[model samples]
Target: MPELENNFYNKNLKPLARNMRNDSTKAEIRLWCEILSGKRMLGYGFRRQRPVGNYIADFLCKELMLIVEVDGYSHNFKMEEDVKRDAQLQALGFTTLRFSDREVMQDIENVWRTLEFWIFEGENSLS
Candidate 1:
């Protein structure tokens, strides 16, 4: 994977990304505050609503080249679009993990465990 450069961040999307950060959904807020904020997830730093390429990722850990998305009801109608977007991100060297809003809101511990396990596996692969 190539190193992320300034060009990887779409400057045109900055305002939209900022708006998303400020107007985060309840699930997004919970995920960020409880699990991902302040390098809390195995000390991996995550940025919310970070602009990457042409899209703004919900949560991005640049070091891991990972993006986590909290999909709401609307996402059910956009599965194909989501899949394409994930593929595009993957092409850019990112691994995207997605969770439904209900999973994040009602079963937060599971979400945390899933993320922890993924990180653990990734670290082991490096070894």
Candidate 2:
């Protein structure tokens, strides 16, 4: 039996998510190839470009109820949208973590540590 269920997602969005996965950004590719793929996040499974609710998450670990988003320069102008997206995800019982593209490219170790803390230690710390 699966340990977690993805009841918050929209089935219709799967096609869009698949398309996004096919044309991933540089940051998304780097993160997936170097860290999040191959069940590498402490043996957790992560799916790239998954839709939850009305939005497509950058990356999702259903078991952890965690969404990891890699933000590029465009995100600077999309703060409002990002905030709204985060709130919607939060409403559906998921946590969203955002990291800058520079951070993922230049300081992946720190990103890994942050993810580790969130997955293993920070769940109880959420308000």
Which candidate wins on lDDT? 1
Model 2 agreement with the true structure over 20-124: per-residue lDDT tens digits:
999998889999998899999899999999888899999998888899999999999999999999998998889999999999989999999999988778556
TM-score for candidate 1, residues paired by index: 0.96
- Residue range 16-41, candidate 1, lDDT tens digits: 99999999999999999999999999
TM-score to true structure, per model: 0.96, 0.90
Cand. 2 Cα-lDDT: 0.90
Question: How many angstroms is residue 66 displaced in model 2 relative to the true structure, after the best TM-score fit?
Answer: 0.1
**Stretches > 4 Å off in candidate 2:** 1-6, 122-127
Question: Which 10-residue window of candidate 2 scores lowest in summed lDDT?
Answer: 1-10
